[model samples]
Target: MNKENIFSMASESVINSDDKLALEALEMAKSKNIDLMELLSGGFSAGIREMGEKYASGEVFVPELLMAARIMKIITAEIEELMETSDMPKKAKLVIGTVKGDVHDIGKGIVCSIVKSNGIEVYDLGREVPPQTFIDKAEEVGADFIGSSALLTTTMVNQKEIERLLVEQGLKDKYKTLVGGAPATKRWAEKIGAYAYCEDASDTVETILKWVNEREALKEMV
Candidate 1:
């Protein structure tokens, strides 16, 4: 099928909350030799963004949002497998987590989906991740960025702790760190020495892309 048609099918599946139909779109993309990234950007990512906006506007509820996210996860896993066998340029690598003391994961999961849709490689540490785990994973993977999400005031402090440990390990300059979630603010991020603060998932993608591009430019200059 054509690109427009494929995107329409995928989006309809999302709007109707049909996981099976979403998987069908994924299979169709594979069979049509569509670019996996294009499929993700146009189909799954666009669908999820629309869903999120609807959720925000109260046109849809939490259950519907979660269902769309679940479908996107399935599509993403398939695309990730395809990426493994294809000769695609690797984008920035990121280590992401919901900080310690926070069991909330929906925000982090949404951010992860959007980031991965943009073609970045993500190492998700899941929820309730300790500060040292963030440092260790970022260091171990030589991550280009470390992203922390916390839904509560208590857990948000863990973002600052992560930065402190990075400095203590003498790795503060080795990676850029970004923070987000309901309680995160630009002022808070600045106070904690985070490279950037994103107020939402869309902002998170833009911020990381800018940071990645600037880093590449500096490397070129050197």
Candidate 2:
């Protein structure tokens, strides 16, 4: 097949979460000496970003977003494994979870993929995660950021509770806290004393990156 066809096939495989096809596309790209980074960043990341936008705009629903995220995970995992032996810098580590009493995980999963693609290590805590579990895992992993997602208005309050617990335990400043999901806002994050708030998966990366960079700058100033 032509180069464009091969790339298109690869992009489709990634969007569809077809591991076998993705592997086939990888081989084809290697044989044709195509730009792997272009394939990943342009083809794969673009596709997932499109789907994420659709989900955010209500053009697509949760199931579609979940499937797209799944595909993204499969494709990126393969590429990350290859990059491990190279000179590429590793990503930051983040602990993410859906707050307690919230069963919705599609938002968290999407954020995980976006963060992972940005070269961050995302330790996903799944759905209905308690505040203490988040604290424990953040401490356990020495994570750079702790992200909490809540889909419901009632459950969103738990994000503040998490910050309170962290403060009470003297771990409030140990890690940057980020709050997100359908019900989250900058005002809410500020009220909860969170370091940042994201409205979507892509924005979350920018927020985390900014937070990390700012912290590093502060450390240097010290």
Candidate 3:
């Protein structure tokens, strides 16, 4: 099969959440020595992006998303192992999400992917997530951070609401809060009491690890 067909096939498998098809296409890419990163950024990512849209629209369930994420993980694992820079040590747990009223998760998905790629344990709450959901899941899992995204000015208010609840509930000191999106700025993060604000996946991953490591070191010192 031609390279274009292979790319298309890779995307279809992920969009459909067909494990067999995804694995087959990945194997084909491996054998043909195709650029796996191109396959991911071009085809597989395209498929995951469609799935993200469906998820945000309520057309797909979180389980379906888990399947898609797993497929991408399988693909990225092989690619990561071959790369020069190795993956980070998995040490921190984060509740990642998009705040309520925002149905866009494209940026959230990328951030989650990057965090997972860097070996952080991310419990993605998906798009349009309620504030309580973030707290509940983090508490249940004992996560170290509350990572949030708000693509709209309206929904960004929820970030402050979370901060308020954390203080009201006396849980403010328990978890670090991270916020981001198109309209999210460092100033806004400061105003809302978010620990940090990241502009993109790369920045998010880096900051999260740094914060987690610093916290870990402090813990060790005490």
How far in Å is the alpha carbon of 94 misplaced in model 2?
Answer: 1.0
For model 2, the stretches where C-alpha displacement exceeds 4 angstroms are 1-88, 219-222
Candidate 1 lDDT for residue 10: 87
* Superposition error at 101 for model 2 (Å): 2.0
Tell how far residue 54 is off in model 3, in angstroms: 21
Per-residue C-alpha lDDT of model 3 across residues 103-151, encoded as one tens digit per residue: 7675676676667777788899888888988999999999998998997
* Candidate 1 lDDT by residue in tens digits, 149-201: 98788889999999999889899988889898878999999999999999776
Per-residue error (Å), model 2, residue 138 = 0.7
Model 1, runs deviating above 4 Å: 1-87
Q: Poorest 10 consecutive residues of model 1 by lDDT?
A: 81-90
Q: Would you list the C-alpha lDDT of every candidate in the order shown?
A: 0.82, 0.79, 0.82
How does model 2 score by TM-score? 0.63
Off by over 4 Å in 3: 1-89, 219-222
Provide the lowest-lDDT 10-residue window in model 2. 82-91
